[model samples]
Target: MKALWVVGDIHGAYDKVRALLLRAGLIDFGGQWTGGDAHLVFLGDYVDRGPNGVGVIRLIRGLEGQARSAGGQVSALLGNHEVMFLAALVFKQGDPHDRLGFREYWLENGGQPRDADQIEPAELGWLAERPAMLRVGDWLLVHADSMVYLKMGGTIDDVNASVRAVLAHANPDDWGCS
Candidate 1:
């Protein structure tokens, strides 16, 4: 059987992630993919908490391409933090309610200001396209382990489509509801 590797809740710990991947021989010291033909899945929460969220995302995105070229696969699931980050970026002016805006909410929840500032349109589009859940063989991968995904769809395709639709919209309320 092919080997499968899983990582979760990176929280912007780029250095640690790099070190771990190096130690595991998944990447070289130069931070390039070395895990040829290996299946690696990131279970989300790629941003906030630590630092270098942008770096982390960039690394993973690069690795995805490299891994594909090497006959390996690198995939990511969408975590709540990703949603919070996107919400903040898309709705920088804050929500309509007097409570708290997306930016404020993200910051309050361990979001780094630099990460928010460094995000580019491509990165935002990439993050928005991530699926809320994924299935590999018998494994049903989800970020939150919540039943809320059922509301998205009965099938994985449906859920991913629904999430894509939600992300494509500009309304903060739509994002909040998702």
Candidate 2:
């Protein structure tokens, strides 16, 4: 059986994340994936809070390719922070009636300036395209412990589809509903 690992709510704690992975023997001193053929799943919140959100993203993105080349798999789920960040980027000007705009909301919620400043288009696209939920064997993985996903759909595939659709439109209401 292939080794399986799951990590969640990184919240920009790059050092802590690195230490944890190192302790788990998943990565080496050089921060390279050493777990050949292992399946790793990140449960999101890769950005915001602490510092080095961009660094964390860079690490994960790199690890994804490295893992794949080693016959391993790296999967990331969409978290609320990602949605908020994307919203902030897409609607930086703020809404008419709302006191706080997307950027303000994101900042208030621990958004790191460097992360937003250095965000690449490809990174944004990757975050926006992540699935809201996933299922592996008998395990069902979701970022939040709320019924909000039900608003998307009954099945995992449906929920992912709905989330993709909402993200495609980049409409606040659609994102809010999802």
CA lDDT of every candidate: 0.88, 0.84
User: Which residue pairs show collisions in model 2?
Assistant: none
Number of the top lDDT candidate: 1
Which regions of candidate 1 deviate over 4 angstroms? 94-100
**Per-residue lDDT over 8-120 for candidate 1, one digit per residue giving the tens place of the 0 to 100 score:** 99999999999999999999999999999998999889999988999999999999999999999999889899988888877775346313477888889999989988988
Instruction: Provide the TM-score for each candidate, comma-separated.
Output: 0.94, 0.92
lDDT of candidate 1? 0.88
Q: Please, what are the lDDT tens digits per residue for candidate 2 over residues 37-121?
A: 9988899899998788777888898889989999988889998998888877776654652334778878899988789899899
